[model samples]
Target: MIVTVQPTGISAADVLAVARGDARVELSPATVEAMAASRAIVDDIESSGRPVYGVSTGFGALANTSIAPQRRAELQHALIRSHAAGIGAPMPREVVRAMMLLRVRSLAMGRSGVRPVLAQGLVDLLNHEITPWVPEHGSLGASGDLAPLAHCAIVLLGEGWVLGKDGARMSAAEALHGAGLRPLDLAAKEGLALINGTDGMLGMLLLAIEDAAHLFAMADVTAALAIEAMLGSERPFLPELHSIRPHPGQAASAANIHRLLQDSAIMDSHRDDLAHAVQDAYSMRCAPQVAGAARDTLEFVSLVSSRELVSVVDNPVVLTDGRVESTGNFHGAPLGFAADYLAIAAAEVGAIAERRVDRLLDVTRSRNLPPFLSPDAGVNSGLMIAQYTAAGIVAENRRLASPASVDSLPTSGMQEDHVSMGWAATKKLRTVLDNLTSLLAVELLAGVRGLQLRSPLAPSPAGRAAVAAVEPFAGTPGPDLFLAPVLEQARAVVAGRALRGEIEAAVGPLS
Candidate 1:
């Protein structure tokens, strides 16, 4: 089914469906008429023969340069050609698709003065699974992700390369012909309209936000399994304990942990402090505080994305009264700051999770599980290197979590100085989220194996179910085996692609 584009609204889920999932998108009837209305205004400006910023005059430092009506069409092509200067490896295909989807959504708002065919061309490219060969670099993330979006725009004109489904690069013209569509002859201001929004950074943020939401839930699940496996008390996660501080995310995480560990004989076995340490390490003791902080950050970022989804982020937006006025709505400062904050939170989540995995490996720290959770510590190395791998990823997250938004370089001959670098923020945020899921999965795998080692002491029903949910991916636990594959299996579970539904089946909706 198609996701109908509306003027005032679009949701993150809707973007994900069209961008990542195989959902087609099109302009609603009202949006089609709206585009016609906005396009007519641009035609009037063109016939008047006066220079408008992006409509007839040059861009950025060259804004004072004027073009005659005969050369106006050439001006649009030149704008796209010069700005399609991105260099680096190609960005992930999913992000490119999302960027395309969002660009069309922005156009569908009818403020950019683009014709319907321009929007339809983007939809056609997406529907045909033809992704523009968008480079990973470029985009100071202000002036609307110019470099990256230009790569996308170039494909619309049949002038650049595109990625086919078979992972081969083909000419944009070939891709368009195969998809039964034609290249756009960009109308006035349409070139600036294509590359002049926050879509590139905004698209990455939407997917990262979605990924973060799932992994944050997995954090609670893994933290619960870690708590029971380590013989930690649930008193710290008590609803009454959280009510005093009253951070909604904290309360929610604590409640989930407490509920998942319910009816556990392992927890019951240590109810009176019969054998285990009186307290857990900070990684175990402070699960909710760290994870909950990340959860709250996720919520904040989502709110920002939700606002951006419905916004008219174009520069020189066309008002209802036919006034085209330059505006700074194209600035990416909001998204830059939000993505940076979430990256910090995500890195911490990984850091703490890695500590827990290390603790589970250390016999002295594991509260009497075998060394590295291996029964034969000398003969079998167990997950010692697996913990190392998680630690390495955690360290990388630390490196990546440094705020990209804080760093700016002057561009457009200093006419556009002090960029948000939001594209950089969202790019690294994706990496941090990836590392976070792996870190949590390492902890979950070790925690579950440790739980199995405590044979006579049964886990809570939900805990057992979590273990069962990952059982296929995690494989039958034994002495040392190929640990990388085992962790990869568990990572899928923690990433919520595999076990979330089954675990939620046994427990309930998480977060």
Candidate 2:
């Protein structure tokens, strides 16, 4: 399918499509008109021989320095070459693609005064899969991801390197030549326009935020399964209980939990026969509060991401009235704070999930199930070690949860006196997500085991569908077996493969 860029909006799903190499870009007519208008203003500025920041003068600490018109092309080329200093491992292909798409979107907004041909070059690169080999590190996420973006921009001039389809690194010239493409020329602010934006950091954060949202939902579903497996009360999720102090996320989470457990014969049979009449432990009972808080965090992150995606986060924006205005929209503090918050919320999910895994493995807390849910206690360690792994991840998540946005270091001779460090936070959030996925998987495995012990009484339709999805991949617990594959399958289920159809079928349709 062809994905068009509209000034009205962009979606996370569209970004994913571009990353996956399905690129058919259509620029909005309004955006094209805006680009043409901005270019005219830039031409007038050049004709009048007036100096502009990053256009006729040097950048950042060297902004006071002037470049003569005779050396303008050399100046722009040198700006790209000298600033392409990103170091560390190459970023994933998807991140590179996202960076390209975001830059294209920003340029298409027509506030950066880039030429149409230069903007189209980015689209052409996306279409032909000629992705630049951008590195993971080097952006302080201030000054608009200058260094990392320079790496991306250099490819347009056929100066840097690009990754080939066969996983080989080739010079941009070779890649373009092999694909029947020609190198581009930077006219006026084209180089600065390409390299002066928050696209790099924003792209990474967008993907991270999207993943965090999915995991947030999965965290709630997994916690619900654990609640039933431990024979915990559903009273905590009652609408009446949450309505008095209604946080929308909390209320919505309660509703979702009630829906997930609606048809559980295990819950019904246990509620009637179990000796305890009051409520379950906080880990099982307050699952909504913990998971709902994460969902709320995602809600705020989504708002921030949506705004950043549409914003013209570049310096020296060209006004519609043909005026050039220098600004600091490039500052990444907003995104940095959002990424840190996301990490903290994701860590909480892991924290509570670890506790549920602990409950399932404990003899006293497991409600008459064998210790560690093992058939034979001594011969089989059962899920004992899995709980330990989950605990270890939870501890690590606590450390990773430290807010990266809270810390800052001076750079650019203190010209960039405050750094966002948001990229650092986003990177750590990805790690937190990895640990959370594994931790949730462990809890799912334990919950399924506990559910098996309660059988004869059927699980809820959602729970049964979840169990069936993993059953094909899970083996009966035995001595000293590897659990990685089982964890992977469980993760796939939580990520929308296993119970997705059943859940959607019941819920009708998802927005």
Candidate 3:
């Protein structure tokens, strides 16, 4: 499908489409107009001989130095080459695509004063699936993710390495030329306009935010399954109970849990079962509070992303009245804090999921379930070590949950003082997501095994659907087997595969 850029907004789904290589991109007329207005400002600045920050002078610690008009093009070229110093593993192609899209979108807003040709080059890269090989590290998350974005700018100049459609790394010149394109000669403020922004951090966070949203929904689904597996009370999720204190996320979580348990004979039958009693443990009862907090964090992140996405985050924004303004909009404190909050929320989910896993394994705590959820506790270890793995992941999450935003170190001889470390925060959140996914997967697998021991007692319809979704991926307990694939499949479901779709079709869409 043709994915035209609209000034109104871009969605996560559009990004996913581009990542999957099923979409083409086009610049909207509004974007073209914005670029034209921005370029006009640049022309006026150049023609009037006013010294703009990046356009006429050097960057960062070298900002005081001025460039001669004759060497301006060389300065722009060197700016990209000098900053293309990112290191570590290459980022995923999707992240590169996201970075390009974000940069293009920001430039399209017209405040950056980049020429229309430069913005269109980014769109062309996306449309042709030419992804720059950006490294995962080297950004302090302030001063606009300079290193990674420099790599992107280098690709535009056709000087860096980029991945072709066949996944082979080739020179950007070769990649572009092979597809009937040529390198761009950046005009005044074009290099700064392209490289000077939080798009690097913003791109990764955008993808992570979408993943976190899906995981939040999955958290509720997995919690519902565990609640039914333990035959826990449904009273805590009652609408009237949530309405008394009405936080939107909490109310929404309560509603989701209620919907998952609705029309379930297992839940209905256990409601009056005195053996299960009036209340469940805190892990079961406080699911809304923990999960809802994560949802709230995501809401805050969405707000921050919305602002940053459309903003002119580059230094030296060009006003329509032909005035140039140097500013620190490139500082990433907003995204830094948002990423830190995301880590905290994600850690909480893992922490609570670990508790649920513990509950499912401990025979006394698990009510009627066998020790370690094994039919033959002595002969088979069953899910004994799964809980250990879950605990280890949970412990790791606690360390990762430490806020990167709270810590900063001065860089660039202290001229670029107070780094945001927001990129670090976002990167750590990705790790936390991976750890949480595995931990939750382990729990789901263990809970299913425990439920299997319950046999004809059967879980709630939602729980049964969840179990059936995972059952095909699980194997009966055997000695010293590789359980990674089983854990992976469970992670896929917990990450929101359409396992619930079958049940949804028979019943209705899961709330």
Candidate 4:
């Protein structure tokens, strides 16, 4: 599919598609016209004989300094070279692609006073799969992902490192040549426009939101499996009960759980049986409430991502009129808050899932299941340590969930004080999301084991399919083996592969 970046708007799904390398990006003619018009304003400003913030003057603390016309090109080049100061590991290729796509989307709006060719350079990189080696750190995510994006912008200037179109180490010049493109000689205001935007953080947030949607749904699917394995009731998920709360996420989660738990012999047998307690543990009883909150967080972050997709974020953006103005539209507090909030909610989902795994393993609490789901109870140690792994990840998430946006530090000689450390928040969020998947997978593996032990009493339709989806790799449980391979496979299934789809097929699309 082709994703057309217009002057007016773009979609979250389109961004995801570009990130995943599933779609091509086309810059609309209107976007090209807009860029030309905006560039005209910058050209006029440069000729006006007055120093503008980014066009003629130096950046940040150096704003008062002006460059001679002969050295203005050098100034743009120097800005990119100096600001490409990021350290540590390179960003993943998909993240780079997403960020590049968003940067192009912003430029297409023509509010950044950059030329059409500059935006096409970004689109061309995506088209040919030439990913710049962007560092994961260095951006405060205000003044809009400056350092990270400079690393990307320098690639377009053919002065930075990139994995070439063929995915081998190469210089940016070599890569762009192969893509039938040239290194740009950046014009006035062009360099600042290239490097100034929320693309880096916002791109990751968009992809994370997409991943979280699937993981959030799987949270419910796996939670149902755990509940059924432990013979917990689904009465808490009744529409009558959820209708009172009316939170969209809570209601949706309840409906999914209710669908997954429908027509269960285990639940039916325990519904009236006095052996079971009046209710299950909060982990089991309130799965919807917890996972639902995460779902809601995902929704809010999506809203932010969508709004950001359409916004022109930069310092000294070009106005629709002939005026050029400096503004704080580049601030990342909105994205920072969303990313941090999501980490907290996603961590809780993992936390609750870990608790359920603990319950399924402890004989006293598991009701009838063997300790650790061990076949021999004393020697096998089946999945006992896996629970520990899950616990550790959940515990780590508690710290990662602490808001990074609240902590501020001055930069650029205190001219840019009270900065938002959103990049740190988002970088940590990536880890939390990965850990959440693994935590849920351990619960899934344990729950399936418990269900197998139940014998003659099979799971509900959705639960049966959910188990079937992973059982091929997780295997029928037994004594100790190299369980890591199996656990990783189960993690893949729960993180979003075949299991959820199998369950949806059986129960009809899980709400």
Candidate 5:
């Protein structure tokens, strides 16, 4: 698929296709016209010898200093090299691609006063599958992920490392030459244009939102199966029950659990019995409430992402009326707050899932299921350590959930005081989601075994499908043997969303 860059902007879906799906990119003629118009304004300003913030002067604390026209090209090159000082492991390929694509989107808007060739060069990089080596650190999320983006921008100058078409790490010079691409001599404000935006944090935010959608939907499915494994009541998920509350997420979750529990043999067996408790534990009964809140939080985050998608996030943006003015549109506080909020939501979802895993292992709370779901209580450890792993992750999530946006630190010689720490927030959000995936996998392992221990009573059709999907990877309930590999395999299944896919196949798509 080819995503055309236009001055009107692109959507989050378009970014996802380019970033993860390796979609080719092209500059619309309209974008070229916009860039040419903006470039004309910049060229006039340059020839007039008027001092603009980025076009004719130094940056940050050095903004007051002016440079002669002869050294302006060198200024742009020096800016990219100095800011490319990020030191850490390289960021993922998808993130770099997304960042590069977003930079193109910003420049295509003709707001940063760059020529059409610059945007076309970035598009060429994407089409050829050449990914720059960008480190994980060095972005304060103010001045819009400067250092990390500089690493990417430096590749355009043919002076950095890149993952080539074959995914091998090679010199940017070699990669560009081999691909029949020429190195760029960055003109006035071009380096600042390339590096100034919230693309890194925003890219992470978009990717996290996509993952959370699947994880949150599957969370409901896993909770439904856990409820069945514990023989919990489905009455709480009734539509009438959620109708009064009217939170869309809650209603959707309740509806999913209710649908999954339909015609459940175990539920039918307990429907008329007084022995089953009048109410289940909060973890089981309030599953929708917790997961639904996370759903709503993600909706808000998605809203923020949508706004950012159309934004021209550069330091000195060119206006339609031919004025290039410095602005703080590059600040990342919006994305930072959204990422922190999402981390909290993800952490809570994992916490509740962990609670359910604990309930399945506890003999007292798990109804009459064998201790730790073990066939022989004393002989085999069965899933006991899995609960421990889940608990540890939940604890770590609690720590990670401490909002990164709140701990603002000043940098750039105090010129950039009170930065948005949005990059840190997005990075932690990824970890929280990863841990959530693993935590839910542990729940799936125990929940499926608990349901299987019920024998002829039979789980709901969705539950049976979930069992079949997971059993191949995690193996059937029996004496514990080589449990770490089982947990890892189950993690892969959950991460791949195979369990959710099977459940959806059996009971239609979940919300």
Candidate 6:
């Protein structure tokens, strides 16, 4: 696949294709022309000798200092070298690729006053699979993800470490040489333009949103399975019930649950008994409500991500009228808030799932299922420890759920006093989602076993497919066997999308 980045914008799908799928990247002709036009403005400003923020002047706390015209090239080089100070372990390959693509997309909007070749240098990095070895720390997210992006920008100058096409660490010079590409000689405002944006956080946010979207869909499927396994009433998911509240996400979830439970024999077996407790517990009955809220939060986060995608988040933007102006577009508050919101929402999803898993393990709550759904009760120990694992992850997720955006410290000699910490937000969001995936996998294991113990009483067609999908990983339920591998295999079923795929194939697409 070839993703032609336009001046207008790129889509989240395109970003994923290039970042995760190694799709080739190309700058649209219009983007090239737009970049050339913007560069012309910077050149005129450079020769005129009037002081500009990133053109003739120094950066950050040194903005007021003027530079000799002959030393401007050195200034750009110094900016990249000095700012490439990120520390910690290297980031994942896909994240670095996404950040590079987003920065190029921002420059392609023609407001960063950078040359076409500079933007193409980034594009070349993507196309050739030359991923810069960016460290995991050193971004305040105020003046963009400075340290992280500068780590990337240094590669453009052939002065940083990189993972070559074979994914082995090497010098940027060596990687560029192998790719038959030359290092760019950045001029004037190019270095500042390269590093000054919310690309890193925004890229992480985009990838998280995509992953969350899939997991949210899987949340509905697993919730339906849990509901069936517990012999819970499916009435709460009635469209008419959710219609009154009318939240789009809620309605979609309710509809998914409703369709997933259609004609379910496990539910049908108890329909005649009004004595089956007046209603199910909140975790069982209100699955849609909780997961629905997460869906809605993801939608809002995606809206913020989409807007940032099309926006030019440079420090001093070049105007169509030929004037260069400094603005606060680089601040990451919006991305920070979005990433934190997603973490909280995802944590809630896991919280409710843990509750449901706990219910399945306890004989007091799980109706007639043996303790821990163990076939041999005390001797087998069954899935008792699985609930413990789920609870532990849920507790950790709650800590990760604390909004990173709320905590900020001054940086750059108080020049950037109120930093966004959005990078921290996105980083924690990844952990939250990972925990959520594990928590849901626990629910899948317990839920499927609970359904199995309700012997001879079959589940819905969709539920039957779900059981088949997991039985291989979970094994025949009996005396306790080696369980670590079983639980890990079940987690693969949940995280790898096999369970959702089987359920959907049996019952068509879910909401």
Who wins the lDDT comparison?
5
Please give, for residues 56-168, the per-residue lDDT of candidate 3 as tens digits: 88878898898888888889899899889998788888778888887877787778887788888988888877889888887898787889889988988889988766766
Candidate 3 accuracy as TM-score: 0.95
Pairs clashing within candidate 1: none
Candidate 6 residue 152 Cα shift, in angstroms, is 0.9
Measured on C-alpha atoms, candidate 4 has an lDDT of 0.87
User: For model 6, what is the alpha-carbon lDDT of residue 186?
Assistant: 82
- Residue 393, candidate 3: alpha-carbon lDDT: 91
Quick one: ranking by lDDT, best first? Answer: 5, 6, 4, 1, 3, 2
Writing each residue's lDDT as its tens digit, candidate 1 over 324-416 gives 888888889999999999999999988988888888888887788888888888888888889889989988999999999999999888889
Comparison by TM-score, 3 against 5, better one: 5
Provide the TM-score for each candidate, comma-separated.
0.97, 0.95, 0.95, 0.98, 0.98, 0.98
Clashes of 6: 0
Cα lDDT over the full model 3: 0.81
Candidate 4 lDDT over 159-277, as tens digits, reads 78896545555788888888788888988888888888788888888878878888889889889889998989888999899889989999999999988988888778778888888
Backbone clash pairs for candidate 6 read none
Off by more than 4 A, model 5: 164-168
Candidate 6 local lDDT, 1-511, one digit each (tens)? 9999999989999889988999999999999999999999999999999999999999988999999999998999999999999988888898999999999899999999888999899998898889999999999899999999999999989889997556567899998898999998989999999999999999899889988998898888888888888888888988899999989999998899888988778889888887787789999899899999999999999999999998889989999999899999999999999999999999999999999988988899888888999988877899888888889999999999999898899987788889899999998898899888888888888888988988798888778887898787677689787878887887787778666777778788887
Error of 2 at 133 (Å): 1.0
Off by over 4 Å in 3: 6-13, 20-22, 164-168, 475-481, 506-511
> How do the residues 1-511 of candidate 2 rate in per-residue lDDT, one tens digit apiece?
6768765446767787788647677677776777887889888887788989877888888887888887777788888888899888777788888888888888888788877777778888888888898877888877777878888889989889988777677899998898788998887777788887778778878888767767776776778788888888787888999999777788877777777777789888767774864868888888888878888888998899899887988889998887898888988889889888888888988898899889888898888778888878897788888888888889999999998888889987777788888777777888888888888888878887877767778887767766776667775544545776767777776665447667657653221
* CA lDDT for candidate 1: 0.86
Give the range where candidate 1 is weakest over 10 consecutive residues by summed lDDT: 470-479
